[model samples]
Target: MASNVQVLADSWIHLLLNLLGYGTIIIPGYFLIKYIKNSQYIERAGNGIFSRIILTCVYGNTYDKIVEDTIQAQKPRKERSSFSDCSQLIFCFLGLQVSYLTWGVLQEKIMTEEYTDLSGSIARFKDSQFLVFVNRILAFLLAGTYLMVTRQSRHKAPLYKYSYCSFSNIMSSWCQYEALKYVSFPTQVLAKASKIIPTMIMGKIVSGKKYEYYEYLTAVLISMGMTLFLLTSSETHKQSAAATTVSGVIILIGYMAFDSFTSNWQGELFTQYKMSSVQMMCGVNLFSCLFTSVSLLQQGTYFTSIEFMFRYPRFFWDCIILSICSASGQLFIYYTISCFGPVVFVIIMTIRQGLAILLSCIIYMHPLTLTQVVGVLVVFGAIFLRIYCSHRIKQINARRAAGIDSAKV
Candidate 1:
């Protein structure tokens, strides 16, 4: 009876701590949303203590600036010639392939390989949060620099709004790194490729968006492919049964959930704000760095990670290059979408995902069964089918629009 009571007490303590952690993120977001919704109340409240507190803490004297910027209409972009567009499309495709492929290899290497510690003993760097901080900080710096160098529309979105997506982004990235400890890199890559299912689900839940029948069909195909891939894994791989453990599967699920939410939230922000991609990147990474640094500091691992980096020079260089690749990858994604449209960008990314898996297998000597190969082909084939169907739908819509315009004329 006493032991049972102790266990119950510990469970309550754990639950409470989790709630507290969530509240730290949620409570602030609640107020920010409230402020955005009730800006008139803020203006009318007029120097009251509560109003002043909200304004000072949340808006920080940028209320007028944000209002002005938000109300200003964005100018439409000029159309580019076909040759220049093709050139940019090729550049972005290559940049994304190189940056993300290198990033993937370094990521797997850093997570799976052992390095020398300060005491000259081999140790693996288990601090996933620290790696997240490194990636975000560098990306934040790069985004900010890009914004400074180029002429961008004045950022009008509430800076606090970025915290919501940043929280999810950090969680997703942390899960990605953590899952690598349990799952093979190829398994993780395949799982990531199958994100359309979760993304569709998140779209419905978050935005009440509806997907077409073919979207569901493609999602099911991807699921089947993922199941076949995981179920037919060879026993000789280094990860073996451990790769498909419940813990790893759960981490991957968390990764997909957070990643889906991050993308959906980003889309919503893009619709609501006229800021450039670099501005969005800058804002999100700024909050990401803040949140991750605080968490690392609280866990007392911030300085420890730094010391580990100093001890292992190779690891230091690996981290630096990893960060650079990540930042550059984001730029490539934006550039690709801007130049070639999302259909082409999706096609390029789908190809990159396939190459990333193949590269990981070759470099790591991960043996694949014939069944697994079939699964991979099935997954990619479904993705391409979905992409083709989407293109058809767009073309159909364009024809309909042109017909309506011609009839009105």
Candidate 2:
């Protein structure tokens, strides 16, 4: 029914689509689990397996740093704590990973019900999505209020800090997910992949990070990888090329902007709130659930989502798993950023993209072409370029320090 070129393109495009969809769900997730392992604060929340060891270390540093800087109250990093704290990190990481493993099924469930949630609410409230969105906001507001009251002895303005970080999540997810509804899978991946550029840009602009020429070179290589995949891919008549590209770009930009701001924002949380990592996580999700709910309800999507969720309980459960995994992952992500900073985190995230591309073809039972393989390799090369540069800088710094010490001697 189709020409060889068209069929080849279709098959290849399908492969890309799986990459985009799965990658979108997976990359951020791995970092989150990794983040939890790295966070001393979360590990210290209780007496358990991981909490006793890792939590003590994470929080010990956390407490020492925040106390020294903010309050001029000094505490040693190795001070012994009666409570064991590492189990929280263990549970958090395990819970997040389990969720990620089940994400495909859960996401499928959410996809079916999510739109109805927004559209259904429209009849009762002219801005029904907005109303439910408000309720979801109320949920997080409740968390913020409770934390502020309960933790009042610590510091003021956590509400403000959490508000900024959480608020960014609401905006970023809304824009990116909304745009995702209209685009193809591969388009989404490339667009999302392009985020390395804007993130690099924002990191330079807002975070005062510099980019090397290799980083630029890496970007070009990744772009080529994507372009090859795209060229070998077929188009959906659902939209024009321009429209699709624009939407993908918007998604990429939104992801980049919010993620950059949020990552930096967390450093403040780790430094200032000094709250347990789990507590910070609960705080963000608590807010996110509220915000997303209100936005959907005001648009009448809330009631619709509910109707479908109830009608398809099984499907809804899937979304529940996905949402929870996603939420927990967010917590891990905060820890990762706090532990390794944005650059390394991005490298890990991008590497996951290549894995996603590889797995999606197999998992989805799609055939990959030689060109598609080439494209994937090219993208990987790009990721390596950025990661190598980022890694090299750390090594260089250590060498420089050694040199300085020798000179001083």
Candidate 3:
């Protein structure tokens, strides 16, 4: 027993060392970016650093003024959409859909199977926490660079708040990847349809927000739809590896809770700090990179994942594509929310989810039962009802404010 305890302690020490090494990388990378941002020689020479080249390619100029203008293109306008605006909107919508679909398929493919024999035509592909780490790190680096170039790095909130949000964000990411290993993409999407329920519950619990009767009814419909869908999927699970599992459902539930809490926390922080969407994205992703790095290091997954990737170039490219798609989707999501309101964003996402389910079923040849069809319809109905109810509430508030203004006059 003493020897066993000693061995366990030694393992923990090794894990600690690994985590420290990852920290060394993150800290130096962050400082290097900051140093590059402040460098006078790069500004005078206009061609000294790689960051300048990237900024020039992305923004047509390496100067701060030009980068600022290019970043402004991301901002959503409240005015009428021009022809250029419409064209850009279409491009963004398509990009968002394609990126989301690609990542979903790639993740499912990577985790679905492992080759048992060397004679297999394709190499083994497995999910790695290190892949998650790399994804976060790459995204963070890109976002941080944008902030630096655009002079937005000065708008960060407290590191502690970002750290807390990062923990939740990484947890959501981890749960999602793990859940995908056990659940079909369509089933997982269906389960996630009830995300509004958790958001509502958390709002009430954490912020004391009140909801209307119709909203509660809509939540109930969503819950019923998800339950019905699950019930109808039992036979599918028996035949399909991607079918829903209890473990997957549980993990999804945890994901919903964590995601809801994190979103609300972010809202609270934004309100308190008066930060922009760009700053929120940068800060959350930056800290998320730190958290995931520590996790992959302590788990010692980076070495194994890297080794496997070297052997299977396809898997390596798949992981990279997954990360790129995810980042692209995020940018489009932010652009959409900024251009349109949250309601419009919700509608677009609802449509996207429907298409994803349809495409997944067609591509994977998964059977959808009549009960599931009805359930999906019910869920969609609930979503529309929520949208209508929200509009009604807004109208009521508008009329009340008008009445008060008239009374004051």
Candidate 4:
């Protein structure tokens, strides 16, 4: 059985390499279509042979779909209790879960593998930094290709326009991986779950906007839950608890601080530029790839990592899978936020994180202390409470508005 699984894995690696090598033939054709789409005489020249072929093969119904979707988004959409909406929600939920789980599993597998006997170069290159670098580059390439194919560029600003957000995002991702070495995955997640607190604080500082009472309460609950979880975690790892906590706290502090700004920055960009999710993703990742590339070179691991990858093809395969999952996960997140409101999006993500913790414990056989369970429950309760409070507020406001209208009548 083990041999069969190994063979299957090897087959996949080979297939991925072949696909990567041969995928460039369509590049020229893609750029040609993009140029034609951007040209003012496109309609008049539609009868030309080259234009006809490009329109048939690439544009066809896609052109109409993009225009219709953009127009629909601009208008006030009427909410409908429809089967299609339900199906879309279900589909997005499943896709997000699978993509996220797959990325996490692949990362853990790569990091925890038997690298002790490997050469120093191979060991060093297998760190979270390398993984993140490769993932960002892949995502950038994919996003660029998407733009070329669609002939769309919503934000024409320089790449540096997104540099700060991209840098913070990449750093947050790196810190998540770094913290994994000191704390268990569940512990790392619990630490990240406290991001709501810092995010609220940062949002207020950045935008000078006050949050609702429920938002503040929710943030407080999450902070308390994380504190409880950390306290219990120390008790479990009594011997090394001090060192682990110090290191984990440092890493997680960086992660949370950077993460708190990322959402706000992205929101600012969207509001200012009216950029689509793909445009935002492409811009951020393109700059992130540049930043990561510089870091890898500065650390002098770029060549060594390539050498290591050549020696162990499986490592390369895992990185490729990680990249694909990261890209897909981002798109799924954007799609969910666009289709559903942010509240539904947050609820869906909360569920995803809960499942991730559960699955990590099951697969890794990590002990979830009773206190930790309570912490999880507390965090989840806060989320549910926020949802209930929001609903109640909306109801009260609606009734008050109706009363005012009746008085005016």
Candidate 5:
């Protein structure tokens, strides 16, 4: 048995497996994007309760299904809307709270564990301990189960849908998970701002969407806000010493880029494939699980310590909670991006960031400065600016159509 195991664990074999895993994380994005462009629903809803083996079946007539019908007629789309399904909003709120809290809390744990960012995160994966092994298993199980259940209840087979949207969703998640292992919570928020650039570029290329002058101005303002916050609030600033904050900032930037890619790609998906948020999410998570599991195996032989949760129940419990939090936050983030445009969604996220920052100040009591306050305000302003630009553009298009109608008349 041991010799057979060794045979299977050849470096070449393991390398192939690992690459496949990493590929799983991003490759599906192509399909996801294709789904977006196809302009229709591909996945179905799961049985109200999710199962590990099932793939959520998307409504058959997804392309033909009216958006308002899903939002109004049956299975709940977003609970937050004032529509009849508003009650689902309560769970949705709890879901959002759990998601943010988990991201914030796990982020703190990562720091306590002395991780700096994704580039460095691979190191932690190298150190094999029973507890972390258990964590890998649990994370895989929880996240994977959710993915499968979501898929069974929500999606069609890979054969039926566009691959670009699915793949983009997978890449977006892969980057975020990898980043979470490295950066600080607040820095992550700052990093989230980076998505704007990618969104703009993708929008122009894929969606044929042109940016207005104000949009460019808003991007500049967003950059300035980030710089001010970095300069004013960095630990180096407080100590009056030069130091490297580069790692922290880089992790966030990575997160921001992938996140914006997720959103910007959505517009293309909507224009091209017309997939629902849930459908895309199902694809992303399914791919994420496959890759995460493969990555865990390559990190070390995990089966030996799989039962550690039984030995250190407390640690196991903590990790479980953390994983749950992580999962919830991820779900909320994806949902938010899908429901609200990326700009509006991030604007809502800033609320969570502000709360986290305030608590960080109270807990560690980090020194607050006027510049820091201004920085936060600047982010908010940029978010509002994006929303305004989007709204105004919509109105202009509406009027353009009305004018065309008059011309035809």
Candidate 6:
């Protein structure tokens, strides 16, 4: 009887332990399902404490009418006056030029210049990730401030969508900076000018958009010109030849791919959400800061970068100014894309690229070969030809639309 009792007691204890283990797993799984369902319910109902917290924390607005406002924003709105449109375009173009021109100069200075540390040792700021983090965090702050000041339509897009854009954007910028260590600024600028092809490729992939025959032709011309320019480097340009290594070419290719994706994705979001430029900026930069901060922390360079900043006052100020320019440039970028569409924005940026190359050559005295000059002219010619053809296409479409309207009348 005693042996039977002992066996039964042991079996009961084993059964209890098994039940406890199962309970631990089942309870959390049940709660997770309930939590997700509750969140979905809140989204559909557009009310409740959870929804209020999301609106306030994510959007910086706690007004009870946010859902209604978002719905109303989706409705068709009146067009702006032609004069207002022109003025906004002027502001966007000028803002982009001034802000990015300064940004380029400062970027080169920061990456290339040597500064004295507190220990009296000369060091260059090698933390490109830190620079990225600083730029993004400041842009986030500025964009948030703008959104708070100006009344914007309630944003309805899922916040996580911005992460896709932010990741590509950060990678592209990091590539740009890192490539400076490998290539001349002119080379980099010209390489970026060749992004038209990549943009079309990404457009097709991301948005399933089709292109014209002329676009393909221009893309080929641009590629040929780029190859010619890269191959025909001036013999005297030892630094240029030495810097334009295979690694530099690889990094630039990555930049083009990532940047093309970024622009296309952002444009899609604008079309889908009809969100304001500041709202887009705020959303993208918020995720940008989050990703970069986590990266910097994991790499253990966050505090070291801060210490480096304190050691060199000029570098610190340069970073601040760089961040300001970057923030301002971002606002212009989104506004231009939202207003005139990505094609017009790309045209403006292409022009800026040409000017940026010229500016870098003049200030930094980067030597250009005769072939390089011809190559540049060829590339620009192709670009301008593509632009002209695009313009004619638009005109033809407009005329056809007018004809259809007149016939209907």
Q: Against the true structure, whose TM-score is highest?
A: 1
Q: For residues 356-376, could you state the per-residue lDDT of candidate 4 as single tens digits?
A: 666667777888889878877
1-409 in candidate 3: lDDT tens per residue? 6864574465446446645655675566566546655774344555557655434322322244445546766888565434555577677668778878887777777777553334456656554556676677667777777777785433424444565666676667656655665566666656565566676677677556677899778777876776566555543344336656576677678677777776556656654444566666666777777666666666677677777776666676777888887777766665564554333344455456556655667778878889878888887798778767766787798799999999999
Q: How high is each candidate's TM-score?
A: 0.73, 0.58, 0.64, 0.65, 0.58, 0.73
- Give me the overall lDDT of model 2: 0.54
Which pairs in model 3 have colliding backbones? 184-242
Ranking by lDDT: 6, 1, 4, 3, 2, 5
For model 2, how does the per-residue alpha-carbon lDDT over 61-127 read when each residue is reduced to its tens digit?
Answer: 4455555465545545663321232344345445444444465445544444433343344121122
| Model 1 regions lying over 4 Å from their true place | 1-94, 112-124, 176-193, 226-237, 243-252, 333-354, 360-373
Off by over 4 Å in 2: 1-66, 70-101, 113-157, 181-190, 230-256, 267-276, 293-312, 350-354, 363-365, 385-391
Clashing residue pairs in candidate 4 are none
* TM-score: model 3 vs. ground truth: 0.64
Give the winner by TM-score: 1 or 2: 1
lDDT of 5 by residue, 196-284 (tens): 56666666766577768887777767756765665555453332232224543453455555566666665554444445544554455
Error of 5 at 215 (Å): 2.5
Show where candidate 3 strays beyond 4 Å: 1-97, 113-123, 151-156, 176-193, 226-253, 332-354, 360-369
**How many clashes in each structure?**
0, 52, 1, 0, 48, 0
Better of 5 and 6 by lDDT: 6
Model 3 superposed RMSD (Cα): 9.2
CA RMSD per model (angstroms): 5.9, 13.7, 9.2, 11.6, 10.2, 13.4
- What TM-score does model 1 achieve against the real structure? 0.73
Cα shift from native, residue 266, model 5 (Å): 4.9
Model 6, 40-98: lDDT tens per residue?
Answer: 64456467787665544433432434666676779997856546766887799899999
The lDDT values for all models are: 0.72, 0.54, 0.63, 0.65, 0.52, 0.74
